[model samples]
Target: MTEVVIAGIGQTRVGEFWDLSLRSLGVRAIRAAIKDSGGLQPQALYAGNMLAANLSRQAHVGTLLADFSGLAGIEAEALEAAGASGAAALRQGYLAVASGLVDVALVVGVEKYTDLIGPGVEAALATTTDSDFEAIHGLTPAAQAALLMRRYQHEFGLPADGLAGFVLTAHANGAGNPNAMYRKAITLEAYQKAEMVSDPLNLFDLAPNADGAAALILTRRDRLPRDFPHPVVQVAASASVSDTLGLHNRPEPLWFAAAQASVEQALKKAGLSREQIDLFEYYDAYSIYAALSLEAAGFAARGQGWKLAAEGESGLQGKIPCATMGGLKARGNPGGATGVYQAVEATLQLRGQAGANQIPDARCALIQALGGPASTAVTHVLKRAD
Candidate 1:
């Protein structure tokens, strides 16, 4: 099998982009990535998207982006696995390169949630859950997440502010990211005062829906030029897993079994322990999800994940740094584009070009994205190429 390496990465500013169409946002990111890769033409293109059909009335986004971006005849298609669509497309791209089916693959994740706006986006997000068993019962993702948070607190006998640190850390990091939607720093006091979106989850606890696109070019290490401009970031491992979609169907609703399986498999494949990971890019669409992910990924024991944040262990300078680029909280969740955004941010860190969010001597990073309520997890371990 070929060793896949990220050749280039690009992303649009994560925020309300009423001015740009879905295709335009995707094209911008794709063009930027191509330019970043020294203008190399890709043999294939894969677009990851979740809401184009529902929100923008656009489908066949893969061909639309490829043709509009001047790569008309290339093999292209859109892949969707709910919120994990971006990472699913990435998994396809990795297979394409690793199988030697395509020497160069362009993978992009783009989503437009602000086009239709308001409750429609939430309703669309709910489709990722069980339609008859969950969505039809009027359960939004946030409500489900809130249910998990309440259960976590009750099970652990914790206070209401248990997950505040996650939000604070995310906003602090996001303040440094120019492309982040909420760049302002937030404090615990502000968190305490925030309005409650649900009983246990506040406005600060949930990431908002926004418009954005992120793209990256992947190719085998030997296929690159003798002197590639940017530092090479190799795909050390790519693993994915799925669990029960309905929250109530799981044996343990709070335990992210899929996340655990994917992370363990990824770590094993990479021949690296969890301690070797210099940073983590978690799919923290909700603060509760962040804590659950840390627990499921073995960063902390169950019900002890919140302690990592309270003790400054998950901060930028802490033992297991995460959300280094604001994450889904303050960085803004762009639906399917979120997973690719995580990859792009991790690539930047591995390249030592993350500006204010850069980790010193960062050699390896673990990035994971989740579909609906931990129903699907796609995990990847990336390392600085020697």
Candidate 2:
């Protein structure tokens, strides 16, 4: 198979961009990635979006973004796997380049949550879950997560504040990420007193919905300039695994079986154990997810994932630095654009461009994206070119 390298990366700050249209946000990232890649034009475009048709009332995002970016005739189409849309699109671009069918593949993850608000936004988000089984009964993502968190706590006999450390760590890390939406650190007391959004899922427990776009340019290593100025970052593994969509359908509701499988497959492809990962950009859309994902990725023992955060083992200088540029929690959940943001953030660390959030001597990075309670789990391992 041909090698796939991330030649360039770009992203807009994660926040409410009421002024920018969906395509406008995508164009900015596309242009920036192109410029970053030294003006390499893409032969294909894979747009990752979840709510263009639902919230923005626009479809054909791939062609719309391609035309807006002045690359109208490329092989363009949108790919969606709920929250994993961005990583799904990136995986497609990786495949296209890896198969030698496309020299340069452009993958863009864009979403404009501000286009709709209040009930509309809530309704749109609910679509990611099972409409008949989950959403039909008014179960939203936060509620779904709340149920999982409650079950996890009951099974593990955890305290009410068992997961506070993840929030603190994300906010503390976000303080160093200019692109993050919530850059200020919050005190433990602040988190404790924060109002609840969904039962046990407090305001601090869930990531706020936001608008943003992130892009990456993937090409064969041989196609890059002989003297590429930056350190080379290549896609070591791309693995996606899916499980039952409805929560009730699964025998184990909170296990994140798909995430575990995806991580295992990604690690196998990269020829490294989970311990070899320098940093992990996990699917921290919710606080409970960070805990569960650690276990699924083999970083922590089952039901003990929360202890890693409590013990500060997830800090920048600890066992496995995570969310180096802030995660969805502090970065603001950019709907479908999140997975691409993970890719961009992980690429930054691998290239030594993470600034204050940089992990010491970082080289290998593991990034995962979730699509509704791990129904669609996408995992990727990135490595600095030796």
Per-residue lDDT tens digits for candidate 1, residues 36-80, read: 887768999999999899999899999999999999999999998
User: Which 10 consecutive positions of candidate 1 have the poorest summed lDDT?
Assistant: 222-231
Report the C-alpha lDDT of model 2 over 1-386, residue by residue, as the tens digit: 88899998999988988789999999999999998888888999998999999988999999999999999888999999989999999999999999999999999999999988889888889999999888999999989899999999999986899899899999999999999999999999999999999989999999888999999999999998676777889999999999999888999987999999999999999898877899999988899999999999999999999999989999888798887787998988998999999999998998899999988778899999999999999999999986
lDDT agreement with native, every candidate: 0.92, 0.93
In candidate 2, which residue pairs clash? none
Name the regions of candidate 1 deviating beyond 4 angstroms: none
lDDT score at residue 60, model 2, on the 0-100 scale: 91
What's the residue-level lDDT of 364 in candidate 2? 94
Clash number for candidate 2: 0
* TM-score per candidate, chains pooled: 0.99, 0.99
Candidate 1 residue pairs that clash: none
